[model samples]
Target: MLSENKLWYQNSRMEETKALLLQARQEGFRSIRLNLFPAAVAEGGVDAIDAWYQSLRVLVTYGNSVGLHMIIDLHESNRCGVDASECRRLTTDFWSRTAGMFSDTRFDVSYELLNEPKGEMVSQWGALYPQLIKLVRSKDRHHSIIVGGKGYSTIWDLPPADPDQERIIYTFHYYNPMSFTHQGADWLKAHPSLAERRNIGWGSYADRTRLAIDFRSVDGWRSRNDAPLFLGEFGVFKRAPAEDRVVWLSSVARMSEERGITWCLFDYEGGFGVEGLLPAIQKGARRQP
Candidate 1:
């Protein structure tokens, strides 16, 4: 999957998005994940949201025409989690309308209920997700529903596979040893020192062993429940040592494939993007499905 981020949602960038979809398809990406903010798209009311999805239909249609599957990710975070009753209600309502709107489309689409549920919300994601899943299933049972655990979808916190839901796929984001992957990342206020950190190599035997152990555990979980798994996000920041970043990405991606897991790179264009799509991707860091 190629994460185009907000570029695909901006009304002014529709033509640009079309070109991107075509580019991704040509480069062998089978799908694209659209990070969507429903509330931001239609703030006035439900009617506004309905209109917004009508616009989305055009994008989805174009994406499918190019042989790219679509992952409709609800990229909201503030309004989810525990005790946010009003927020929860509004989120639920969005999915209801969203599910209803896309249920009949012939194109391949997957609904990611929410992106990176954090803090208190992560603590109760197991409980919250099933409710949303039930709501979504009521409207659209044909398409797969993707979900993840708390701690921002960390593998260690992955929720147990649900035996009751066959069409559901569990997801996790891997940015382990964040000191390496997130080095020089300014947005991490809690770790301001990372801004100056660089050249953090990550290919020690211990590091490789730890990665294998983590992925194998997830593979075991999938086997136990007969469920599918998706490594929805994984990438190294641009400032990391170039060779080390490539090794890490290649290792993680290849490991996911060895375990029969599908993955989406963290981004196509961003601070953690696969710039030029040549060095890392062509060097065996990425494999097309």
Candidate 2:
């Protein structure tokens, strides 16, 4: 989304991205998961898609060389009514095109079919997932795929894995009790009541307790399904108190590692990121091989 200037995909940003990747590697991070807003499958269609693919390939190739696994997360999907045939067609077609195109991507590359699916998309995931999985597996079998359930990939109501599907990883995003995370945002203050809260910070015993209980559900689901868990995204808003954001992220990182889950924070250059956050997480990590 930041690539919306007159230049679009500016070279300075690309260099900054590389620097961030190298920084993450220097910390204890093993992989990078990037959100994609559009694909060649939309708007300009094939030619557009091919151009996007080639541009991303350059980054992927460099990431592979540097030992950072890349997760290409399709963060947007057709979120229309279940009865709307157009929605399903749009999503299915996008994945079909995507999976076929990246069938031979390097081992370090993976795919996340959709991002934080909500509305009809989440409600009908069972019906939608199999179709997309079939299409992806039909075209590409080399890399792993990450799948998420309803409620914006929260622990609640996560769909279980079908039998014999071993390669798919389960994912969730955590910003639980958004009160503390998104505090003071004017956008969230559109309503009178929500605007009253001020300077909310993380680190209460109640906060820790709630987070543990929520994550325990994910732990249970993973045990039952035997699917690897990926904490694909988690972070407080940039507006949150720096101390609270750092500590909250560190706590979450520690919790994920204790359960053998892999995680990637919300962003590097974004608001949620603090200069010392990655290093802090790394310091506490088990450094699991």
Candidate 3:
């Protein structure tokens, strides 16, 4: 999924979203992640919910025509300072409406139920996921549902499937050894120095086998037996030296391809833009600098 900043409703004009979508397709991206919310919905309640659906109808139609798959991400429902019950209700209601909106569209679409659900423990995610999945299934049975575990959807939190539901795919974000990937990110508490040299634990080949094995180890039993993996989000900040970022990214790409895992770099613009990584990524040759 191409990581796009929240641009719901008029915050991002249709023209802007279209332009970005075109650019993303040109850059070999087939899917774009978007958050759905109506500005008045949160405060206005059910009536606002209706407005949100009307907006989504327009957005999804535009996205489909351009060949960009839409991954409707339920972001900010957990964070953005909302209470848990409110967040959960808004999220559930949104999906219920969303599934209905795209019920007949030909577009390749999927639902990422929530983005990086916060706090630790699988119980938190486990308690609500089955119900949310049922809601989505009720509206659209065939579309794939991407669900993440708690503690920011780290591999460690991935949960086992119900054995009944087979259409869902397990998803997780990867920005391991945060010191390296998040270098210079302002939101991070302490950024790693530009000159620092960090090593990915896999070492040497940095191939898919290592990645799969490493990821499989995160939660021990659950990830190994139950979930099929998707590296939902991963990218380095632009402030990091280009050379370092490229090396890390190459390892990610190689590993992803090897494992048959669908991997997407974290974003399309800002610190993680394709323009920033193009030179090094194009080389497709790994080297130790």
**Ranking of models by TM-score:** 1, 2, 3
Q: What TM-score number comes out for model 1?
A: 0.89
User: In candidate 3, residue 143 scores what lDDT?
Assistant: 87
| Candidate 3 local Cα displacement, residue 11, angstroms | 8.9
Candidate 1, poorest ten consecutive residues by summed lDDT: 1-10
> Model 3: clashing residue pairs?
none
TM-score per candidate, chains pooled? 0.89, 0.84, 0.80
Superposed Cα RMSD, model 1 = 2.9
- TM-score of candidate 3 on Cα atoms, chains taken together: 0.80
Pick the TM-score winner: 1
Candidate lDDT (C-alpha), each:
0.79, 0.70, 0.66
lDDT per residue (tens digit) for residues 44-94 in model 1: 677766666776889888998889899988877655644456547766987
Give per-residue lDDT, candidate 2, residue 124. Answer: 73
Backbone clashes in model 2, listed as residue pairs: 40-49
For model 3, what is the error of residue 189's alpha carbon versus the real structure, in angstroms, after optimal superposition?
A: 4.9
